[model samples]
Target chain A: MANYLKLYPIPEDYRFHRGGQISQGLLAYETWGTLNEDQSNALLILTGLSADSHAARHGEHDTAGWWDYMIGPGKAIDTDQWFVICASSLGSCKGSTGPCSPNPKTGQPYRFDFPDLCLEDIANTSVLLCQSLGIEQLQAVIGPSMGGMSALALILNHKNYTRHLVHIASGMASPPFSTAIRSLQREAILKDENFNQGYYSATNWPEEGMKFARKIGMLSYRSAKEWNDRFPRSLKKVPQHPFGIEFPVESYLEHHANQFIHKFDPISYLYLSRAMDWFNGHQYGTPRGANPLNDISLHSALVVGAETDLLFPVDLQRELHHLLLDSGVDSELIVTDSIQGHDAFLVDQQTFSQLVGDYLSASAV
Target chain B: MANYLKLYPIPEDYRFHRGGQISQGLLAYETWGTLNEDQSNALLILTGLSADSHAARHGEHDTAGWWDYMIGPGKAIDTDQWFVICASSLGSCKGSTGPCSPNPKTGQPYRFDFPDLCLEDIANTSVLLCQSLGIEQLQAVIGPSMGGMSALALILNHKNYTRHLVHIASGMASPPFSTAIRSLQREAILKDENFNQGYYSATNWPEEGMKFARKIGMLSYRSAKEWNDRFPRSLKKVPQHPFGIEFPVESYLEHHANQFIHKFDPISYLYLSRAMDWFNGHQYGTPRGANPLNDISLHSALVVGAETDLLFPVDLQRELHHLLLDSGVDSELIVTDSIQGHDAFLVDQQTFSQLVGDYLSASAV
Candidate 1:
């Protein structure tokens, strides 16, 4: 790992896709391996809802990235061969410019006042970051879930500049069912008295509501079959709870929900979640049943889906594969045999590695 | 239609299985058709979480019940042949005594002070109600979802006293996955600021929390396939809300959630939901791998399940069917073919009525 963990400050004139421009915004990113002589080996990696730039552990920041397993040396996106630059979403709270960040004009946290963000903004900003990094006309891009949406947006804008594309567990837009779930999650957060309409005090956060929202998100992330398999229909030895959460599965969700409060920003969650819901491939003028990457000089692309995924179901992935092939884009689709569902990209690392490893390392970029 | 929407009060000293004792308690009920000269054709119908005694129209109230489609004169239960009586579950707010009712001694609402309830209590209370109605035996018992659990409990205790059983979209106990979902619903209710430790004013209900919980429940009641088929991924033409909900599905859920607040009771939801989680078939001492209805003269049992139901997956229903057959009970398990899922029993009235009508009308008390 060379000139790692860096920030690219975006100037004010570089306005947002929607209204309310950020005078001074920044993108947090971490790069692993050398950027090769021509910089063509650099792979831009994007993340899911709350994932960070730290795609893998490096030096003192010892904390691992959300996609830790996939980006390590000798792993799927081998650091020894490909220069990896994993950038956290522009509106995420993980060191990126977001709701919790200070407003340049007011010098106060933007909170709900933060500029409206969309998927395209994140994708476009990352491309600009690549340009700033002096990486000319370069490498492959890998994204999962929201990251996949951003990858599509990136290729749609910078068509010929990008090569290979790997989109996993995402689609043309957030489906109606998923959008409904997200809206309910936002409702939960908004109903919390402490949420204070997205201006809850940093100290007295809407922890309860945020935790509940995370729990709801967890249901969509994994499938019912996985939960049934992991947690049996038996009571915990501890005497029954007066609150009625004596089952192992309930306990598991509570534990995870608790952990989520400290790490996730409620306002950022609202912004990013809304950003994902607002995204649609048609916004880029891509016609229905038409491939978004057809005009690109992309070498080969891989569209991955989890068979049990309820969020971005496998059917959408199959559609994407067919669309890509019809567009004259060299592409392969892999429906991973996984019960982890939409989260297969994170949980079923082995299958993802098996399906995507050869392709990322196939020397296209 | 005969006597309708009557309340039967229970004297003090009546104790519950979990804890505490309710002194002045009541069970609300409604009946249809004649009980016959011998009182031998009296039928008892139990209910799910939020169901009321108005299982079908009877007198002054005139409004139909949740299962109205299958409970009229020539419907599935056939009021012309058998006297039909549907009683509200003990912990429900529709009519029965619950947490919202005042404490007999304190003159204040029971709130959290209300005694913990279990599924067996609902079963036992209905039996007592039958006895009060001067009926020596129940000709038949029809139960759906949680009502099905109570039905199993009822047969386990009454043995030969009850003649037939029709259980739909339910099982011996709440599965781990369903339990987990219910637990989350409870968490949402508890997390609500206005829940006020379950002491929110009757007029100022914990509307927000209850509505959010209902939205979560609506997800489990139906399958993803049904949602997809019902709500397409098309965007609403009103430009787009800056805050994101631009889909018609969002509008549908928001509308339903708003309606839910006016009807469902938050405290009743919490207490009754726990009642379901606490219920296990083994509590009645039915040996493992042994059918709880075996020791009785159950003429036949029709176990119906939905093909797409996610809450009570069809697998459990299959197991119950096999167990009934093994125990020598003349059981006919009819798995309903529908995309409506757990709510299929409520929505797919034609299919349920067809499967149950033939069996209920085939014999007599």
Candidate 2:
């Protein structure tokens, strides 16, 4: 595979949001289009829980990025008019420093020794990367799912850092339902014998645990309606064993889970998932006796939610829009009738691209 | 604990619906009130997947039954006016002949050697129990959740077995989304090292797998709205370990899972859950070139569903009602606004009791 990923080394002794410091820290990213003379066209794209920095392809030989359909030169993000930068989250395995990364002092994987990761840390590091790139101010910041939480952290931590915000399928903080599902996913991994307290080797990896966790994640990420329409209750084949797959839906989940078990690092997944549960947006303004989103200083904002999003239900996005307006920011909320759930933004390109494309065009300064 | 459970023995070798024979078969059940002279006032109550035959308390020392609130004298079921019989399904562990039972021929637990138990078998055994009790006719048959599916099987297979039907929170067949969730749950247990291919000993039971499966089951049994109301985004305590319970919801799931792990047999759960996935009501009617429900001789039927039910959504019940009406049976559909989800019929007594009581009273012959 041709490498399109770029890395930025942070200055020594970088601090994290929760506590502690890392001797070595790095952020993996990719950029497209041109940084204008005044650097005002810069737009930062943050991603969901498992996404990496490769948001889109840069060359014909490059493997397709996670969001390649929506981020190219003439796509929804439109690199022709905007200098877009997409960064892998700090506590991730996609060419970034995480639990899987080696500790400079010990010459061993940080594993649980890595400091507590927060969406705040991801927001902070991405901002530092922006500064290092000589971009003093951002024209806009686009965040979807977990990335939306990081975007909130970015603007709240550094007021007026961006002019516009595009928040999709995310909330101010995690809800109890999502929290329960995530907790179970983590338990599946930690209880695996092969996990061995984070000392799992390549040959004896926690494959079963990771596959189970990913299956649970897939259940929450997509909508019931989509599955009903796609797989129905049709039998795939006669089951010879008691617990074997019989329905097409079960087979679909197995395929997806097997593909994901080895692609992502288990320890990193644990850290990032916990970070989402710990985030409380109310802390941002509770001390001031107001809504937590009271300080986001964007000139305008566009919030997008889907009717079928079970993980981050559309109501959370509605709440986000309400808070943004109360905080005195010009905000618009769009609730699409997409049937693909929280993952609709990734695959429902026609609807999402037009919605996002129109909003960016209208927000041009 | 005092045993309020009663048992009935099958005469000799009994054939199963899916091609197997049991040398010894027994059904555990409980009854309230008395059978009338003609047995026309006898009513049969079927239960969900995990429930036993103890629908309510018969004595002061007897433990409260799973549906004690709505099954006693002057309650919704009004046992004073009707004799009510509730039977544990044949493939269950609650005092019923199941995989946990010893095979009469080999003096060993049937385990995987047991026949493939279907809802049809449950319906057949319950009907035989009714016959042994000298009941020629029934006033009504009430089934909730899995019991509702068995009720359909009973009326479809026996034809005119009951004069009226009350079905709650069930469907004609399991939907794809539910099949996916149930498949993952079974995988959780089957993947447990301690499970040991159904030969798991008491000392080395698949406790972790069972607990995990129960947690997933709980997620589907209840509604997100109820969880949001009961356990909000409040932190229970600061998580000391990475995967420890951090949110109130996570703690709630853990508590419930621990209480359920050893209460039910894991192998029985696997069989009952798979039976639900394999059922197709259409199969009954396809051979005759008509609706499967066309043979059901009920004078009236009441179908109850909750808007919040994720496992068996309201739409399924609506389809059931439509099918019953199309098959020439008088039917009414009630979509309750209760936030209790699929388990609402067990907990939301006020709504369910009134709905059922009204139907039975009107249909009294």
Candidate 3:
């Protein structure tokens, strides 16, 4: 398949949200459809932690993207009706300048030397990418999961950037439970002997730690109902070893873990995962205790969540919906009865497409 | 504090439910109140996975036990009116013959050489202890969490052993979600380098693995609501390292994990945890495809579960209650609003005490 990724250079001495700066940075992005004459049809798409710029197929020669089913000619976030732009988040390894990217100073990967990353930084960089493309205002900005936090960051920080917002499966702040789980995931990597204080090489990669972290992620990503329906006490095979994969669920987790460990950079994963925990959109409020998202100026906002999502439960979305209303923004909340949990937005194509498509179509009027 | 523990040895040939036999087996136990001349007042207390025989204090000189709030005189179990006996489970390391015990055959810790232990084995061993104590029949058998499985095993296998049962925070079988969590916990221990195939020495103990496992356990034991109320996004301190404990929740988990890692035997944990997953009460059915508990001649059974329990959820208990009713047994299910989750039986003193106390008092008639 053809490579649809396009890199946009960040201007010199770009500052990070937390601290530090990169002299030279790049953001990989892709666009579908065309910018309108007035540049008002641009719909920016912010992504979850591990997603790339490829939201869907650009052409027959291009590979299918993560959100392939939700974005296309007649699909939700329809590219034909609106110019859609998806950027690989800042600090991600997916063709974006990150810990895995070569440091200009030493000609080596930044690794731990990379500045602390935050969702705010991810939002800011996407704004930069949009400006570079000569788009001043977007018709809508859609985000899901980690991207949902980044979308909130964008709207909270750059109030006039988008006329509408579509938030999916995220909370304004990471609850204590979510924070604890992410902290444990980070611990897995840090405790890995092969991690070597973030100096791990290609050969000495912390494969076990990455695999463990991904398994933990998989556990939280979906609901128990889904697993029960998929593999309740069904052993794929008799376990030969004491700690081996006994249940089909174990094998399912092992399969995903193995597939994920080698695909993502460990340090990048650590940074992005921590960024989610540190995110508190309420911090953007003018007064110390005010709801930060209360005053956002938007024509409309659509919040969607899964009934079974353990990570980003529906109550969080309900809170977000009320916050938007309290902030004087027109907002609506849609809860899907999808058993896939936090990951339902990604895999519950039919439900999400219907929700997003209906909202966007109505908003365009 | 007084030593409330009493050890009793198994007869010449003690066979495990799954397979294997031990020539010398030992059980540790503690009791409160007096046994009636006819043993009609005997009340056996089966424990959760990690509990010992000391369910409550024996006297002022004895150390306060895990269930001190629930098992004392005038408390939930009401020792004043019942001869209450609680025993360290057969596969546990609390003063019992377990993986940590010296094998009579090899004169060394059994470790991986220990036979596969099941909840049924734990049930059978508890029966032996009761029989040895000259208690031919019991007024009631109360079990919570892992003990609930053992309690079910007892009723299913030894139908006439007890007149009443109080099942708390467990199910007839481990649901796929609960199994997945436990399977991951075992993986953490097995992967620890210092685990050394269950031959880990005192100095080279798999502390990291055990700590990780316990942290995972703590995550499932309690409710997210409790964590949010207790810790929220409150940080204990500014982290000095990238992955240090920053959130109060992290430190809370760290405190519990550190305390647990050293106290519990890793192999014993592995064996007992797997037993919960492998437990299938239906296997005891006399005819194929019948309710295993259909013929149990119990006077009454009480099933209790927490609404917020992520591990052994209330639905499981509800299912068990329905199954018991279907089996011709008089049973009731009580769902508590306590936010402590699966660990509510241990910590929600007021709620559990009221429930257990009221039921036992009613059952005495």
Find the candidate with the highest DockQ and give its number.
Answer: 2
Rank by DockQ, highest first.
2, 3, 1
Worst 10 residues of 2 chain A by lDDT: A1-10
lDDT of 2 by residue, A1-365 (tens): 23657889976767888788887688889998899999998999988999998888886778888988888777888899999998889989988899989999999999999999999999988999998999998999999999999998898898878999999999888888888789888988898789999999899999988988999988888898888789855577887787787789888988999999999999999999998888877777866548877766789999999998988898899888999999899999999999999999998999999999998888884
lDDT of 1 by residue, A65-135 (tens): 67778877888888888888888799899888998898878988897788888888998899899888888
B-chain TM-score, candidate 1: 0.94
Candidate 3 off by > 4 Å: B286-288
**How much does each candidate deviate from the true structure in C-alpha RMSD?**
3.3, 1.6, 1.3
**Each model's fnat?**
0.50, 0.73, 0.57
Give Cα distance to truth, residue B223, candidate 1, Å. Answer: 2.7
lDDT of 3 by residue, B1-365 (tens): 23677888977588888888776888989989999888899999999999999888888777889999998777878888899989899889998899889998889999887889999999999998999989998889999999999999998889999999999999888888888889889999999989999999889999989999998878799988888789856456888887677888888988989998889899999999989988977677678668778789988889999999999988889988988898777898899999999989888889998999999989988
lDDT of 1 at B32: 87
Better of 1 and 2 by TM-score: 2
lDDT, residue B262, candidate 3: 85
Return the clash pairs for model 3, or none.
A294-A327
Q: lDDT per residue, candidate 2, B1-365, as tens digits?
A: 23657889865666788989787688999999999888989999888999998889986677889998888889888888999999888989988899978898889888899999999989888999999999986788899998989888888888878998999999888888888889888998898888888888789999988999999988888888888789856576877776777789887888999999899898898889888888777678866546788767889999999999999888799889999999899999999999999999888889988998888888884
